[model samples]
Target: MLRCPNCNTHDIGRVGTNQFYCWGCFIELTVNDGKISSIHQVEEDGSLSSLNDLFLGDGEQDSISL
Candidate 1:
């Protein structure tokens, strides 16, 4: 099961082919090759702000089995 790297919760919902939204932390996650490639925060204006640094750190990637 895919879990949110931010909230560590399993309350992630698929928003697209490889995109997922985390209800626990209100963040969007993009998966590639069964790994978390990017993360974003859903702003009130419906804009996305990158949260990769906060979650994955500088140039690092997190693994998540599809």
Candidate 2:
């Protein structure tokens, strides 16, 4: 299973094709080609705030569950 690098939580639920939501931290994770291309936080206004810079490492590639 894909784990959240921040919270190390595995409570990820698929919200769309190749898109997953982290129930633990209430964030959105988008995986493409077995890599996470974007991370966003869902706001109360139903908007997205980019959280990639906080979570994505310098050379870390996105991960996918088998």
The most accurate candidate by lDDT is: 1
Model 2, TM vs. native = 0.83
Q: Compute the lDDT for candidate 1.
A: 0.90
Candidate 1 wrongly placed segments (more than 4 Å): none
For candidate 1, the per-residue lDDT at 26 reads 94
lDDT of each: 0.90, 0.84
Q: What TM-score goes with each of the models?
A: 0.91, 0.83
Tens-digit lDDT track for model 2 on 1-66? 799866889898899998888888889988888888889999989999998887786957666663
In angstroms, give how far residue 2 of model 1 lies from its true place: 0.7
Among all windows of ten consecutive residues in candidate 2, which has the lowest summed lDDT? 57-66
Backbone-clash count (model 2):
1
Native-to-model Cα distance after best TM-score fit, residue 19 in candidate 2, in Å: 0.4
Check candidate 1 and list the clashing pairs.
Answer: none
